[model samples]
Target chain A: MKFSKKDLIKLYTNLVRARTFDMLCTRLLAEGKFVSFYHEGAWGDAAGVGTATFLRKDDILYPHHRAHGFPHMIGKGVDPKYYLAEHCGRATGCCSGVGTVHALFEEYGILGQSAILGAQFTVSVGWGLAAKKNGTGQVVVASFGDGTLARGTWHEGANVAVLWKLPIVYVLENNGIAQYVSLEKAYPLKDMASLAAGYGMPAVVVDGQDIVAVAEAVGEAVKRARQGKGPTFVECKTIRVTSHGYGSPHMVDGEQRDMNMVEELKKREPLSMYEKNLLKQGIITKEDIEEIAKAAKEEAAAAEKFAMESPIQEDASILDQYLYAE
Target chain B: MRLLQYNEAINEALSEELARDEKVFLLGEGVGVSSLATTRGLVQKFGPDRVIDTPIAEAAITGCAIGAATMGYRPIADLMYSDFLYTAADDVLIRAPQWRFLHGGRQSLPIVFIAGSGGYRKVGPEHSHSPHSIMLHHPGLKVVVPSTPYDAKGLLKASIRDDNPVFYMFHKALIGMKEDIPEEEYIIPLGQAKVRREGTDVTVVAASYMNYLAIQAADKLKGEISVEVIDPRTLEPLDLDTILKSVIKTGRVVIVDEDTERCGFAGELMAQIMEHAFDELDAPIKRVCAANYPIPSGFLEKFVLPQPAQILAAIREVVK
Candidate 1:
C-alpha cells in the first residue's frame, strides 16, 4: 500500500505535534503545573500516530496509555487543549476534570479508557460487536502495550473476536516493558504476534520507529476489518526510550538500564527518523520540517495557556452531580 | 393474574425487554440453554445476533456488556452464579459502575448483570453464596434482590430500563417458587419496600430468600407476637424511609439476611436504623444472619445459613 505525498506530510505533522505536546507536558509535570503522574511516549510516537491517523471519525479507538494517549488522540483530530486541561484537572477538561489526563473524545469515536491495563481488551469486543451489528462498516482499533498482552482478557477477548469475526484491529505497541518489567522477562515469545495464531487471527510485525511502515501495516489491518475480515493483530516492535513514567526509576528488574543502550535507542527516536525519511523523499524539506516543529511548539504553548486559564474543579456539588445519571 | 415461576418471570422480563427495544441483547456462557433456566428459549426467540452465547469468560462477557452499553446498546450479561462474579469482579464492581462517573457522567451504561445467588441448591461454597454485601459496599451499582416471582418480573423490567448498571441477584432457592403476576406489563421501581405482612409489635426487615423466611416467621408468631415484615427489594437505593416509618410505628426491629453476619447487609441496615430512629427504639435492634463462615454444602449448610427459627428468635429478643 503506497501513501500519497499529502498522507506523508500529515503523518509527519502528527508525529511532530505528538512529540511537542508530550515534551511540554513533561516539563509542566516537572514544574508542578500538573498533579497527575505523566508517562512519556518518547520513541513510541509512530505506533500511536500511525495506528490512529487513517481511522474514520466513526471508528472507535481505545488508545494505549503511552504518552497519556497524546499521539493517538491528536492523530484522531482532537485538539490538545482539552487533553492538557484534563491532565491539569481543570473544569474545561474533556472529562470535566474528573479523569486526570485520560482522553474521552466521543465525537471522534475515542470513548474513555480504563486506568487498569489490558481492561480495554474485553471492552473492545463489545465495540466490535456493536459495529458489526450496526452494519455501518465502522471498525474498532484497540491499542495497548506489550505488557497488556499477558492479561487473561487478552486471550479471552481475542478468542471471541476471532470466533465471532468481529471487525477490530488489535494494535500492539511492543515497547518491551510493562512499567519496569522487560518483555523478555514477562513474555515467553519474542514476537507477540505469534500469540494471534492460536486465535486463528492474521498477524504482522513492523518497525515501530518508522512512521510509514507502521502506518502502512495498521492501515491494511484497518481496511481488512472494515471489509468484514474479522480481526487482525499488528505488533509494532517499539522502544520506550525513557523510564516507565516521568520521575520514576530507570531500573528494570532492580537493575539500572545501561546508559549506553538508552542512548542507542534514542538514536532511532521516531520524530527524527520520520523527519529524515520525509526530507529524503522530498515530501518535506528541512524548512518545512522546521515550520512544522515551530507550529507544534506554538500549538503546545497555546494548549498550555488554555489549560492554565481554565478554572479548577473544586466544587463539592460535583460529587453528587457526576456520581450517576438521573 | 397469571402464575409464573421465579426463573420463568425473569425469562419473561428479558424476553419482553429484547422484544421491546432493538438495542437490548443477552450474552452469557450458556444463555441459549441457561443452566438456571432464566434465559432458556431466549436464543430461539431473538436468534443468535440478539442472544449471544459466549465462552466461559466472565471478564470478557461483562466487559462486552459494558462496551456495548457505551455504544448505545443495552446488554444483559448473565454470569450463571453470583459466586462466579469474582472472576469478573474488576468489570462488575469497578469498571461498569465507575465508568460513567469517571468519564464525567457523560456516558450511561445501561447494563444488567444477572446472577443466581444464595444456598439451598447445596452447591457448596463457590456456587451458593449471596454476595450482595460486596456490591452494596460499592456506591455506583444498583442492587436488586427479589423474593418472589411477581417481584422478580417487575423489578427486572425496571432494572433493564434503568440507565445505570444494576446487579440483579436472584436466589437459587427461589428459582422454582411460584406466584401470580399481572397480565399487563408492570414495572416495580427500584428502592421501594413492600410490606409483606403488616403487624405492630416489631418491624422485620429482610431481603431475597430471607424475606420469604421473615414472612413465614411472622405467620408462625401471629397472635403470640405481632411481626411486621418489610422486604426491601433494592438494597442500594434502599427504601430507608419506609423502614424508618415502620420503625417509628413498631419501635422495635429485627433484620434478617442470608449473607454472613460480619459487615453484612443486615449490619448496615441496623446501623442506618439506629442512626435514623434511635429515639423511637424501645429495645435494642437485632440481626438474624448466616453465621460468619463460608456456607457449607448439604446438611451442614443449614448450620451456616439463616433459618426461620433464627428470625423468630431475633424477633422475640428484639420485641422483648
Candidate 2:
C-alpha cells in the first residue's frame, strides 16, 4: 500500500505522541509524583498509535492498561492533561482520580481499558454484536498482549465472535513476555494467530515496531471488519524495552539488565526506524523530525503543568456516590 | 387486585418493562425456552434480538451484557440459576459494578441481573440455593429479593428502571406460590421494606421465600407470641428504618435467611441492629438461617434447609 506524505506525517506524530506520554509518565513516577508507577512497554507505540489512527469515533477499542495513549492518539481536541491528572489523583482526571492511568472515554470510543488479562475479548465481541444489532456499522478493536492469548477468555471470545460473525479486530501485541514468563512457555502454539485459524478467521503476522507495517496490517484488518466480514486477528511481533513497571530494572532471562540490551533495543526503536525509512524515501525532512519532537515535548509539558494545577479530588462523600449509577 | 403466581408476576413485569423501554432486553442461557418459567413466551413476543439466548458460556454471556449495557442498552441477564453467579463473577462483581466509579461516574450500566434462588425444592445444591447474600456482600450492587407476587412484578419493574446494577433474585420454590397483585401498574421502589404482618412482641426480618416462612411462623405464634414480620425486599438497600422502628416498639427481633449463617445477610442485619438499636433491645437478636453447609441435593434439602418450623422456633424463642 502507498501512503501520502500527510498520512505518513500524522502516523509519525502519533507514534511520537505515545512515546512522549510514556516518557512523561516515567519521569513523573521517578520524581515521586505518584505512590507507585505501572507505565511500561513504551515499545508498542507503533501498534497503539498506528492501529488507533485507523479507527473512527464510533469504532470501539477495548485497549490494554499500557495503551493509555489510545484515546489521546485517536481522539480530537482531547487534552493529554487528563492522563497526567488521573495519575496525579486530580479531580480533573478522566475518572476524578478514582481511576488511575486508564479509564473509559465514551465519546472517543475508548471503552474501559481493562488491566484484566484477556477479559476484554468477550465484551468486545459483545459491543460488536450490539453494533450489528443496532445497524450502526461500527467495528471494535480488542488489543492485548501475547500473554492474553493463553487465557480461555481469548479463545472463547474468538470462537463466539466467529460463530456469531461479529465485527471485531483482535490485535495481539506479541511482545514475547507475560509479566515474568516468556511467551514460548506461556502459550503452546508457536503463532498466536493460529488460534484464530482454528476458528476459521483470517489471521496475519506483522513486524510490530515498524510504524508503516503495523499501520498497514491493522488498517487492512479494520477495513474488512468494518465491511462486516466478521473479525480478523492481526499479531504484531512487538518489542518491550522497559521493565514491566517503574523503578524495577529490566530483567533478561531472570537477570536484571544494566544497559546490556541497550544497543540491541536501540536498533528496534520504532521512532528511529520509521524516521530512517521516512528520511530515505524523502517523505520527511530533518526539520520535520525536529518539529515533531518539539511538539511532543511541548504537549507533555502542557499536560504536566495542567495536572500540577488541577485540584485533588475532595469530598469525602464522593466515594458514596457513583458506586451505582444512581 | 388480581391473584397471580410468583412466576407470572415476573413474566408480566419483564414483558411490561420490555415494552416500556426499547433499550431493555433479556440475555442469558435458557431465556428462549424459559427454563425457569420467568422468561416464558418473552422470546417469541419480543423477538430474538430483544430476548437473546446465549450458550453455556456464562462468563462471556454476562460480560457481553455489560458491554451491551455500556452501549446504551439495558440488559436484564438471566443466569437461570443463581449458582452461575460464580461463573460471571468477574463481570458482575468486578466489572459492571466498578465501571461507573472507575470511569468518573459518567456512565450508568442499568443492568438488572436476574437469577433464580432459594432451596427446599429438592433440585439439589446448585439449582436450589439462594445466594442473594453474595450480591449484598459485594459493593456497588442493589440486591432485591422479591417475596410476594406483588413485589416480584413491582420490584422487577423498578429494578429495570433504576440506574444501577441490581441483582433481582427470585426464589425458585416460591414460583408456584400465589398472591394478590394490583391490577394497576405500580413500582415498589428499591430500599423500601414492607411490613407483612404487624405485632408488638418481636420484629421478624425476612426476605424472598424466607418472608413467606416468617409470615407463616408469625401466624403460628399469633396470640401466644405477637410477632411483627418485616420483609426487606431489597437486601442491599435494606429498609432498616422500618425494622428499627419495629425493634424499638417490640424490643426484640428474629431474622430469617435462606443463606447459610456465617457472614450471611442475617449476620449483617444483626450486626447493624446491634450497632443502631442496641439500647432498644431487651435481648440478643435471633437469626434463623440455613445450616452452615452446602445445600444438599434431593430429599435431604428438607433437613439441610431452613423451614417455617425453624422460623417459628426462632420467633417463639426471641419473644420468650
TM-scores for all candidates: the values are 0.99, 0.96
Name the lDDT of candidate 2. Answer: 0.82
lDDT tens readout by residue for model 1, A62-81? 98899988999989999989
Candidate 2 lDDT over residue span A1-326, tens digit each: 66788989888888787787787888888888853456565776788777777677788887665545542344223466776788888888888888876666777786665567777887886688788878777888888888777887776678778877888999888888776667777778778888888999999999888878877888888888878789999998887777777766567558665475655765788888889999998999999999999998998899899988988877667788868665
Off by over 4 Å in 1: none
> Clashing residue pairs in candidate 1, if any?
none
For candidate 2, the share of real interface contacts preserved is 0.65
Model 2 misplaced stretches (Cα beyond 4 Å)? A67-78, A252-266
> Per-residue alpha-carbon lDDT of model 1 for B75-98, expressed as tens digits?
999999999999999999989988
